[model samples]
Target chain A: MTDKIPVTVLTGYLGAGKTTLLNRILSEPHGKKYAVIVNEFGEIGIDNELIVGADEEVFEMNNGCICCTVRGDLIRIIDGLMRRKGKFDAIIVETTGLADPAPVAQTFFVDEAVGRRTRLDAVVAVADAKWLKDRLKDAPEAKNQIAFADVILVNKTDLVTPEELREIEMRVRAINPYARLHRTQRCSVPLGDVLARNAFDLERILDLEPAFLGSDGGAHHPDHGRDGAHAHHHDGMAHYHDEEIQSVSLRTEEPLDPDKFFPWVQDLVAKDGPSILRCKGILAFQGDPQRFVFQGIHMILDGDHQRPWREDEKRESRIVFIGRNLPEENIRRGFAACQV
Target chain B: MTDADTASLTERTRAIVPGGLVAAVHFLKDTAAFVLGEAALLLAAPNREQRRVAIHDGGILAAACDGQRLVTGGDDGKVMATDAGADSTIVAVDPKRRWIDQVAIGSGAVAWSAGRQVFVKTAKSEERTTDVPSSAGGLAFAPKGFRLAIAHYNGATLWFPNAAAAPERLEWKGSHLAVTFSPDGKFLVTAMQEPMLHGWRLADAKHMRMAGYAAKVRSLDWTADGDWLATGGSNQLILWPFAGKDGPLGKMPRMLAPAQGLAVEVACHPRQPVVAVGFADGLVLLVRLDDGAEIVARRPGAAPVSALAWNATGSLLAFGTEDGEAGIVDLG
Candidate 1:
């Protein structure tokens, strides 16, 4: 699996320093070669031979299913890049300011040739720290860039005051509490923080828990903490309720019935996959001794038995969803029905 | 042939290491031309003499051979034609340095795509350009006409380079990748983005949906008589019959040579009904269409077999793998 090339997707609103981050990655002295696929070519001044332009063409698969859509241009570009396999160490795809991240993420899942030759490292979103609070209110694409990201860079923090920065962080957290956030000026975060993150790998499901358990005080008594009932206290600030998008975290000590859980989750995603952008879970089955790690992009779910549960580890099931207008009550009751 | 006579014929072939991923192999006369994923093409002669010829400044993206010269398009924005004598010449270059996405060789013309536009250059006339609605996913020239088929999202456009009429559009709902016409010029088939092959009967504009593939159908070839269209996408060799007027519209495809690995490439014999099947696990088998008798040409210990081809006379077979391992088998 290590032989597969790692691809990092960079997204942001216009004037959010995406090109700055790309140029930085290209000009860094890391001694690693990168093939950059950018929608806008002349914006990147780097003279790298591996830099290729993309058209950002998205098309539907499985007979016009919206959730099954993928980037047709990515499927073609990756296939072309694989011909020069040894020329580059990793690939970075920079999307347009108005581009949706769903088609880019789903391209890795839907295309067999792309999935086999390369692994999606992570989705890195660069946000203008001063203007993000306003963009989130007006641009739906800006909110998605934050919610679908695995790592986010709040760039241009020098222009915003400390209090304004705190407000921006709170608003981002209210929408997506899962992504690893970093504050940077001119998008100057460490190169390691954004690249080579195996965010989509099934084995990396272990990292999802810390993102959920770290901030919310509800992690200690998660059973009493029903879905959509986060206390939303961050640095003693009141919960900023962004009504359109939110993250729901569910946990239970009871082992789930695999037969019941599979059908319920499948049906739920089928009905609400458009609203549910991303969902991941590390499940504990009733009779199986192995832990099942599953992750989804829209309606597509990929799950497998990771390893045998260690005796020292607690056999708990935790599921998290970052979506818009999720059926909170129905999801909570359906998950309860899966508990044995 | 008896089962014992055809089994385990791995020693009947001569191995040649090309040392780069072989995207395709085409037989020019008696020489096996192995098109590498990078800049060169390996030409192996019948006497086992191999020569490497550089055809592109960078990676070769698309290639097509018309029994004389191999025409290839590359990331260097140049289209080149190389012959069996190791001689190469630039055919065309994109002024904007766009990656040449697809290429097709017509009777006397060479066609290639850069972004959404396709350029066709004939032997006697200058190049003509036409822009499609989307990026051209695949390009194929009709067997008997000067027309070219450009496969893209929503459908394929059939264009005649000399005609003044608006190009014909065959509307299908999904993105179409590789495309080819039957040898008899009756049907046009396209490998879609989905795991299926969609075809249109040219006479009546009828649609034929060939589904039930586990993966996208990347490689397909018509038999010598155009009786069957062999495809790669499943663990078994799938052949959709096109002998009837309706094509494989209501018929079931004949599946053969079930294996542990998915078949990734298929090359039909030019003079016989046998097919050379290449699998993802680096296995190559020559299976007869009559009874599905299999002859193991290469064993499974390397990368997927990405390319396979037979000489015009069907006396020699050449196969190449993704790991750059190549071999030529003599069956005369």
Candidate 2:
């Protein structure tokens, strides 16, 4: 896979200054050539000469919900890009506001050719903080764009008060507690946070969620009802939060049986994969020093045993599920029953 | 979803209309044909105008035909064969499930490469396996029928299965993806990881670097006379002349049939000076190499045309696109 190119999917809500961020990524001092793919050639024209206009054709799943669906044009476009293997260093795909990252991420895993030639680096999301919570309540697509992100850039922070900013960050954490969050203005964040993150890599998954497997071993409860408290808080203010999409973190200080863990996770994802946007857990398998790191998007799970736990690191198992209306009790019981 | 847009297709073939992504098309025999891709190897009869799906397992990625039998390698790890009759049988399977990336059928033997191992099965069904230095990037059977050349990282090996000697390796600096010996067996060329192609004279093993392509040379074809090797890389067909012993050395290549889009696939007629090129913009053109004259055979579409092939008699032309839309353009 080293020979394969890395593709970074740039997604954001409409008017979140994605074009400016794309322009910054293109004209940066870094001498890397990127093939920029945009949803459409809109008024904010991508100044890159090697821009490809992508069609937002989302293929729905058999379950009939608007979950993970493959983007046909992306496969075609990426395959065409593979023909010129050495032409560019990386690929940056800009999805439309209505786009779901599930299908975009699935294209890299589902298509044999694309999966073999290119790896999805990370999904960087830019959200307009001033109006993001509003969009979250009114638009399911906005929530998807947030939950599906590997990195969340809460842009337009200047437009909101510090308390409002904190509320947005809290809301973002509520939907996706596992993703890397950043606050910026004019969509300006350190370029390193957006590129070559290897966020989905086995080694980096732990790094992405440093608190995965309770690395800090902090006193955390399974039912962290932080979102419910902030779900609709009005200090004579107009900040209302939606609770349909919230994050549920399950942490246990126990070794788990692989046989029980895999199937339970599989069954849970199978029955609720559409509802579960992202699920990741670093498990301490019975008698195995190495941590088993796995993450899933819908039903597609990619995992393997990673490096042995550091001498000083705790061996607790932490599982994070970010989705809509998840069954926390059954999930907690199921995970707890797997303890050896 | 509206559809994958198998592109606004207007069929010109006898009857078969392949839908999905057409990975390749090859003339199976005199009247039968193999339209590769979502169909795997759909057996097509021109006279009877019947299309039957032959290999039904998975999408076919690599395929080659040897006049009578067609061999295909699929992502399913199965090496299969089918003749004009309709039945397709799996010749072999790699238990490890690696993609059988390259397949070649020539001179009574079928050879396929899965990862670093190359397997050859004779018409009598005798099979032999040889491990190359690395995963085989490309495979081609020598016209003389005694040797098979497997291109890999750092070099191309000319494997003489019957001989006791070690396979001759023409060492190069980079990874070689596509390997082929000239029709006369005097020269062997490889498409490298770089956009250039490196070739060597089989007699002396002299280096001949064919460079300056804007992209890696993926599609290659030799004219019927074996004097020119036409390729797809840039917007035009780059033809390297091999008329003299020097073989495209100290000589500029002949360029023909310039198009607005880059050429992705090219096919040379068996008996004529005509070459058909499929472009990235879905345009297909039949060009007369002698005069650089061209006829717009197929117009541009949503998906790029991926494969182009001509019958041995040079009477039938077949083309397939990435969207699984495939048909034949008859040129009597």
Best by TM-score: 1
Using DockQ, give the best candidate's number: 1
Candidate 1 has a TM-score of: 0.96
Query: All candidates' TM-scores?
Result: 0.96, 0.54
DockQ of each model against the real complex?
0.74, 0.02
Report how closely model 1 matches the true complex, as a DockQ value: 0.74
lDDT for residue B185 in candidate 1, whole number 0-100: 89
Score chain A of each prediction against the true chain A by TM-score and list the results: 0.93, 0.88
Q: What is the Cα-based TM-score of model 2?
A: 0.54
Give me the displacement of residue B253 in model 2, in angstroms: 0.8
Off by over 4 Å in 1: A214-236, B2-8
List candidate 2 segments past 4 Å from native: A1-340, B1-16, B32-34
How many steric overlaps are in each model, in order? 0, 5
